[model samples]
Target: MTGFFTVCTMEEEGADPVIAAFYRAALEPGQWHAALRAFARLAGGDVACCFLKAEAGLAPSRAHICGLDEQAWEDGYRRYYHAIDPGYTVLKQGMPGRMYLMQDYISARAVARSEYFQDFYLRAGVRYSCSGTIRDGGGLTILSAHRAAGQGRYDGRTRLQLQRVLEHLPNVFRLRDTAQQAQVHGALAWAALDELPRAILLVDACLQLVFMNQAAQRLLCGPPLAPSLASATAAIVLRGGKVGVRATAVQQRLAQRVRQVCAG
Candidate 1:
């Protein structure tokens, strides 16, 4: 959501840089590794990972991880440990934007006895986990932060921080899907968009204008929707580098709709 970006930017004079990196990764897939590392540090986690959980199984090839071995994740965990992982099962059922602690669902003693823990988790040095479902349509996109044995379990403070971050995950997922679609179609897609009769505008997570089709440009410059002058009211206006509707009632409804779309 755009509100998430605004809050993060204003909090403690921009102490949390992870939010910016997180959004960047949504736009550019290659930045995910660095984004995960920043996220792990912010959550006080030793490792952070994000992957899509499909009906078949976890798609390890598409996973972005920090502080974990890629080979072990693909070969060892996906092949053997995924089915036996209690944490994985709980995460699969977790509500989008809600955080879940593995310790709450299963006891430490139970985890110690499990083959998944003995064979994979113990080998990987991961013991405690805090995860949440980001989006669940075609597949479940899960974001998880893990703590090593000596690091202890995630505390209340950590959980609160993680939950705040989780609120923005759905927006990031939406941006990623948009980016992928654009990449798939390339410049031809832009040309097609320009020819559409309806006015179209694309904004970033921060609500900054990124692209506006020719129709949108014409609409903005048209007489009925012309830039507002103080003496005469106009349907639309551009002020302070942002688009605005002159009518308070129309503006309120438009803003609400924008927030709903951005919240995704």
Candidate 2:
């Protein structure tokens, strides 16, 4: 509410740079928190958050949050809202960028007339809310913010600011996903993938480094820095006191046995 701290408006030239910063930062290894914090700061809201659903059959996860200090923000912040909140179920009827009051939504959902209104949001000082969704080829993501009713709900200007930035939110989530996959894959490459007593060598019978567990890497310099999935099923040295055939063959056999066991 202070004049010195003006929330950036969508129509303002300053908004574009902020938008680009978040878009690029979302792709970085550990910069998501900063990007969301900046967004919440610029929005002057009590909470600004991003949610993403990993797969079609899986529930969504709370991947990012800013300006809230509560116990386990992830649950109430992600799956719980969609699973139980009537306001969100009805938000689908509204236009993408248009701002609407939470009361308008709850009223439409008959929440205003329901037994759950007071205990739900009012006692917690969360009254007004605005939300929007963006989708990529595979799935959709939601961005939302909430504020006390006395603070006023998001106006058209606020909605426009958010809508403009969130136009790129899907791409942010994509890059974030890519970064996470890279990190997990990187860890797996170094992890002792199974309880194999033999130090494995991830190599292609045709001559390529595919993947090596930590035990395997401790034996050699490490499977090549790059492991190609195509080269995973061939015979390679099973070094480091490991008495199995080349890694590729052993892994293939192990996988085949596991499949056979499952089948049986």
Candidate 3:
């Protein structure tokens, strides 16, 4: 997935400042925790998480916890509650991008009696949760928000607010996937270029060398910017003294050859 699905409820240009901040956090790498926290705050929850479940029966491939102690999350959710979670089956079978309330499937009475509630939710102070799925190429992803005990179940307004975020999450994942794929493809192309026999150097618009072929290294390698190649065909864009013993005339011919090779 390259980008998250963006819910159409708010436009970036004229949206509330908080929503704008949330969008920035959601799109940035390693900023999901902040984004989730922003979501929880807006949706009336205390804790939020975004996780990937690669396959049925397997632990989540990845999870980002927002507004929860790491230990509490590990002990209460990752280590145990997930297996017995009442919402798992429902969310698993639910529509990919639709929001679903956890309380609807498991009543408070049922939660009070369940092992997950007694050992996990109660200990962590969470009494209710809501979740929505975001599609991923590798597996299923779920975004969950939790409210503490005494906070009461999520209300209709909260659900509507969460749905706005949910509707666009899938697109976010798609954008991320597309970016990653483009990066991988670019790396492969660079590797192919590196395999060419002639020395090659790639310089950016700033004239700073960003990449050099192995042949280039052998030809001119005291340091970057210190070209030491003896070939005149090669553009010896150097910043140091010449060490090669080749005749100047021969070096010029080789430099020309280098130029031709690079052009080809």
Best by TM-score: 1
Prediction 2 global C-alpha lDDT: 0.51
Ranking by lDDT: 1, 3, 2
Candidate with maximal lDDT: 1
Q: Output the worst ten-in-a-row residue range by lDDT, candidate 1.
A: 6-15
Structural similarity to truth (TM-score) of each candidate: 0.65, 0.51, 0.60
Order of the predicted models by TM-score, top scorer first: 1, 3, 2
Q: In candidate 2, what are the lDDT values of residues 130-233, reduced to their tens digit?
A: 67666644544667677766776566676677667777665455645555675767653233232232343333332234554454554444445345632432
Task: Please give the CA lDDT of all the candidate structures.
Answer: 0.69, 0.51, 0.63
After superposition, which runs of candidate 3 have C-alpha atoms over 4 Å from their true positions? 1-23, 182-264
Worst 10 residues of 3 by lDDT: 1-10
Q: What lDDT tens digits, residue by residue, belong to model 3 across residues 1-264?
A: 111111122223322323434444533566777778777887676788888876566777578888788877776677767887778888877888888988788876887689888877777777788898877766888888889868877887788778777765654555444445657576643454355443445543332355666766665664443333233323354333321223576446544543453454
Candidate 2 regions exceeding 4 Å error are: 1-14, 53-58, 70-81, 94-104, 108-111, 114-117, 136-138, 174-264
After aligning candidate 3 to the native by TM-score, how far in Å is the CA of 233 from where it should be? Answer: 59
**Tens digits of per-residue lDDT for model 1 on 147-167?**
888888778778877776677
Residue 254, model 1, lDDT: 58
